[model samples]
Target: MPSGRTSARRFRNHVAAMVLAVAATLVSGAPAPVAATGQVAPPATAPSPAPVYPITARIVARYPHDPGAFTEGLLWHDGALFESIGLEGRSEVRHVRLEDGQVLARAVLPADQFGEGLALWENSLVSLTWKTGLAHRWDAKTLKRTGSFRYTGEGWGLASDGKALIQSDGSATLRFRDPKSFAVQRELTVTANGRPVRNLNELEVIDGAIFANVWHRNYLVRIDPANGAVTGLMDLSALATEVAATDPEAVPNGIAWDPAKRRLFVTGKLWPTLFEIALDPAP
Candidate 1:
């Protein structure tokens, strides 16, 4: 099998060229809103010398997790954890017990599709497939295969703002889509302080803020969906150090918020444990 990284790198290079071309063509418009409409352009403000940190995470609790599963998407729905695990031949959608990371129900994807991000809207669990140009919807309760949708580009992460589905394609842009129609409502470019933040993966929406993992980075960025500005940054270098002995593919990738319990959780691809964390001031 060809390396996913090789293909991914090629796609990124292509997207980069496309973005540069688009940026050069646009004469003038709102800078901050360029991402909002999926149009690449430079921001009005000049680039900052360094990225700013506005928020962070502090461990609150820790729970055991299966070290073998390569988790890609994670979210809290009702009383269980809804997860999507990747790898084309090993992809699956699982309903897990939050108390002990136990799988209560699961559905296997076709051996050809690698699962990516997941978003729960009302009764449907929308799961994206990496580079497959398809998304599967399942019955959240029964785990039955419900339907599928078509999308262009790579699917990296997914979340819901309680109103629309937010999707990341390993790009700086996050697209808002109608859950029912899968029509793009709007797109936003995420920027940290002043620079475009790309390689966004595994999205989680909490308190109206969009939290995304900056691929290959050690932190999760808090983004303003309205203007694509990064409001906060939380570094996870400590957690990465703890799991340094694990697989190289194991990186921070999962995020879920228990709004009812007011709890936030994060974990990596093949990590042995999932942690509930509290945000702290970065110093």
Candidate 2:
């Protein structure tokens, strides 16, 4: 059997190959797979869904200036914000004030792992590292490392369904894993307009569907949990692009929903603004 590091490298290579293949297919304009009913089928590629949100969001609050944060995961708990910021040497887990983005507490990771997704489960905080294939568990209060487990592929986004830890690895596939053992329980490929959508990142399990941020895009997709079909898309083009035009790294990545307060918060890599939004249901 290959070592954990070797396995991680192999998974990364496979994902890269898959991405290249997708790009090539799009460029060639080849006919994609069909359902075999003598009708034109949807393209195999997962293109971004058209905006369908009926209600426009009003940004309630914006946190500008935490410009060094390469934000990967964000969650709202109690009255504080729990954020997992990425980039190997600079990765950290922090507790911040929701009102002003003030860092209340923080714990830095080792200088080798680029942190990715995070979630609060039970009484501990769970996090995934992008390249290390490691899932870390930390004390929710102290931010002390309690345990670590290995996973396959590059971890991109993670959320909990109140039972299992749901994860995405920059693929069309979404995986559910046992929180304790980190063993994959089942997987589903996300489809938009009957086509598989890859690069699914920054997830939040809202209501019964999975809301994900498509990397490098200005939209959020709501996917049916049972069938992996995209039900709606929310356009956030206006929020991040204003800054993105000036900053190359201001890519939206973090998403957190406050169920109790009925609010949503989004932020990006090295961005100065954190937006508080209210998602109106699609009509």
Candidate 3:
């Protein structure tokens, strides 16, 4: 359940129409929203806990993963799945096998840093730290630490558009950074139903939208890059029934997409099995 959320706003939104209006406003040639006086209208206030539709995952494949793996970030590229696991002292980045879930190569972070997220560029992998204001660089092929850089705030999640990195810091904002120098290029205030959406974590960029795992909740949202609007929200509460939560750190956090095969995968920290899900295809 989501924490500190008042009970009044606890209901989920079932109507798909909530996203329709926003979609129309974002595309080119759409009419601008205006007040009766012909002035631009203000943003509407969103219901505290936005309504979300429950989406059941279709398990395409299941693999044995280490139960001790505190998965923080996950990605699939060129037939391999790379994972980043976290804890102050046990944080590491791994190159894994999807068929058997074997750790073929690994690079461990120093004891003081808590690993958070990972993103892949051309030949490099960039990893974020929880509170250290730093990001580490690694060779994607060898899992070797190549170098490091810095950011201004906490690093919660990371995704790359192949040229630049998009990052979140447990806030309603997403920052776009230059891959080479890590300098921020732009940012957006992510919103759901016109209200800020915080706790954005574990992002996957596929088919022009950013899919994010909302921390501490059973929601996964698709965000529009142009206006920072959450175009779709899916409830994954039923998935929790499959695993009994025993570890305090266990939570739904990792998300990856296989572009070639058009497969979607998800798993949580300390999860024994990884899931391959078939999402509702867009009309």
Candidate 4:
């Protein structure tokens, strides 16, 4: 699936969860987990133990997505969906049609740099690189790379709060940066049940809360921007299973919010479908 620095931690979290699920089934005489079938099955009854309240992603609509796109970032603004695709030699920023997933326009990055998170700051489309420590600025309307700047450390996910840029680097810490200079202004540590949450990736700022996709996981955590505490955890394990049947690397990693329509969209790396969903309390 995903490699490099975050792979080990991702593997650990995945394996630990699977082990717990299997153990619970063996002890309780419940059905065994379907991990062998390449599906990360959800709990048959109540959700797992976690500090934050459980939320379920109720699919409202589905749309086509580019199965070859290794989606790293996604956002909806005005009336369009902009996505950042990853992988060396294949990275691009695309303006996609919401109805059919047709790429209306795209800007390619250098073959050496793996693209990551994307955000819109004012009239500019800002995108980040994974290991190169470079951030590119693009004209929101033209999709042209206007200029570039440098940043410290790895870039995983990015979002804008209408004032500043919020960035994550696979760590529990989220940095608030000056949108103009891209300088770190403040940092927030995301926590759940007093424990730090790592591998934060693909972000969307809706209303005032920060919605983040935990890398390789089928869920998104909603954090309070004022305090960094996870207020809700929305599970999409069913969708994850559906997407990963053929490719195990198709991990859910994209989130976009359409404020005007009040819709939330989610998809995954190499997925062929994008789902518009609504969150509801889990039973």
Clashes of each: 4, 0, 2, 0
Kindly list the per-residue Cα lDDT of model 1 for residues 135-243, writing each as its tens digit.
9999999999989999998888999988999999877789999999888999998875556766788999988889888665556777878898876666676777876
For model 2, residues 1-283, the per-residue Cα lDDT tens digits are 9998897567545534444443456446566433122323334354432422223455787775387888889888877789999886999999888778899888888899988899889988999998788899999898999999998788889999899989988778999999889999999889755668866888998887888887765667788889898766665767776666455445788888899988889888788788989765545
The alpha-carbon lDDT assigned to residue 239 of candidate 2 equals 75
Candidate 2's TM-score reads 0.81
Tens digit per residue, CA lDDT, model 3, 69-187: 98889999768999999888999999999988999999999999989899998889999998889899999888888989987878889999876899988778899999999999999
lDDT for model 4, please: 0.81
Model 2: which ten-residue window has the lowest total lDDT? 33-42
- Candidate 1 residue runs with Cα over 4 Å from true position: 1-51, 280-283
Between prediction 2 and prediction 4, the one with superior TM-score is 4
- TM-score ranking of the models: 4, 2, 3, 1
Ten-residue stretch with the least lDDT total in model 3: 35-44
What lDDT score is found at residue 26 in candidate 4? 33
True-structure RMSD for candidate 3: 11.2
Report, for every candidate in turn, its global Cα lDDT versus the true structure. 0.79, 0.77, 0.76, 0.81
lDDT of 4 by residue, 1-283 (tens): 5665587566446544653452344336455244322434332322234545555456889999999999999999769899999988999999999999999999999999999999999889999998899999999898999888799998989999998999999788899999989989999998765656767889999878999987656677788999888776676777887766476567889999988877899999999999999755333
